[model samples]
Target: MSAGSPVNLVVLVEERSADEALRALLPKITPGVAFRIAPFDGKEDLLRKLPHRFREYTYYWRAVNSRVVVLVDRDDDDCLELKAQLSRMAKEAGLPAEAVLFRIVIEELEAWFLGDVPAVHAAYPRVSLDLVKRVKFREPEDVPGGAWEALEHLFQQHGYHKKGLAKMIAARDIAPHMDVENNRSQSFQVFRDGLRRLVSEEN
Candidate 1:
């Protein structure tokens, strides 16, 4: 691809919130490798359509330079089992392994925001800078009582999203200020590294 040409990276996400978060984050990591995020109504919807999507992508794969990433929240499911299912679907669709990357968020997208307290603080000035020093939040993926609930409580304490967490809004506010290199969430780090590796392999 030329300096100005679009990068052929495609990211398939479970919800608008994931899309919103990645919109701000991908650019930071990918730099000149422009990407596209395709969000489904929800995880179930994405899984329902993934097989067909993979099949259709055969055209894109043959006709253009491209890669697809399927990202989902692990929720209450077994992470390894979920990954195996996704891999099976992609393989059944006959997609080359290099053409797709499947990633499962440990609990949810909010964990990524919690990964970098500085980013959250930068976006919400009321959020305490000392938050990361606390035991509960020091580990983003393992945030006590779950990531989404922890973030909701934190945001509420900071006087934002008092009426429950508005995911897309939170993503919009927090993601732009996130530092890719400084995130402490192991899952987020894996995602960042995997995406960079995928993009680099194309060159």
Candidate 2:
């Protein structure tokens, strides 16, 4: 696609927490990408809200005109049905299955902060079961406090070694911290800046 074209992203999340986090992270990770964050209160909401017509709109209008479409969803069992439905919708829309991406973050927004469980524990020697569980099963109300603090601790405690699986975890964990409404607009800006720096040094 041409540089002038916008990168269209269709993100589906089970709760407000995941929605807000995806909203915060996408633009930062992929600059100039235009996104729509659709929040489903639950499995029923997703099935009812995302009709075949919307799928057509996504495929024909947005997909055709944009550079890419990144679809993010949670990995709960309830979401399995939705995933299959989306896949079929994508095919009907004439888009390649690969063109419709999935970032199934296990156990919702907390997964962003904790990364993979074993990796997180390895990084933080003092982590307790409560802290671990909280990070793994975080709700919307669970955010805006210790969540960000824990993530910051992860980065600091790990010495900011941004590479390999560790870097992936760091990026995923730090991404959700930017979802505070006041900070949303600047999320993409900060992420893009950091990504650029990382890429430059890597090369």
Candidate 3:
């Protein structure tokens, strides 16, 4: 949704790729709710600005009936501690906990795409459908090196994104084919659940 359009939710993501992915995913899960995405340059940028943004969102809530969702990547950090920090930032900004949902993508947004292998295959027909059956790919969030690295490898092996994984293009192409109910990443499921809960509460 456009910034001026009535929005039920405003998602704060760390990059354009995530914003692109959710642009496709949110409509499937959040029926009847209009939403907007605000993408920062990177994780550090988002973390640095969240307090001020949260404070603005507190005002936005009353003015536009919009709630907020803050999505970040866990990377190598401890998940629980990171989540607590986000909650603390919101609290400090005087943004009510109930008015915001903070979700961490266990490694990165690429992990969500890895969680739904069939969606990848749908977007890039050259990718192997048997990827889900592989032992290493069984748990997407647990992949060793890093989620994006793994995705880059896969795309290269399939002759797609040969030079590098074009994150925005990948997200835009794959997200539309994702099966929200079938995604295997626990983090993705948590994200979906939290978003649904937020929508349900308001609706």
- Tens digits of per-residue lDDT for model 1, 21-99: 9999999988987688999999999999999999988766746667899999999889999999999999999988987
Candidate 2 displacement at residue 62 in angstroms: 5.8
Order the numbered candidates by TM-score, best leading.
1, 3, 2
lDDT of each: 0.89, 0.46, 0.89
Per-residue alpha-carbon lDDT of model 3 for 84-179, expressed as tens digits? Answer: 999999898888877789898987888899999999999999888999998878899888788899999999998999999999999999999999
lDDT of 3: 0.89
Residue 189 of model 3 has an lDDT of 97
- Candidate 2 regions exceeding 4 Å error are 1-4, 62-64, 67-82, 93-99, 116-203
lDDT of 2 by residue, 1-203 (tens): 34335445555655665555555566556556566776667656664655553565555654344322323344445456656776676666565543344333333344344433343444444444355355333442234443445455545655554332343354444454443222212223333443333223131
Better of 1 and 2 by TM-score: 1
Clashes of each: 0, 1, 0
Off by over 4 Å in 3: 1-7
Query: What is candidate 2's TM-score against the reference?
Result: 0.47
Error of 3 at 143 (Å): 1.3
TM-score of each: 0.94, 0.47, 0.93
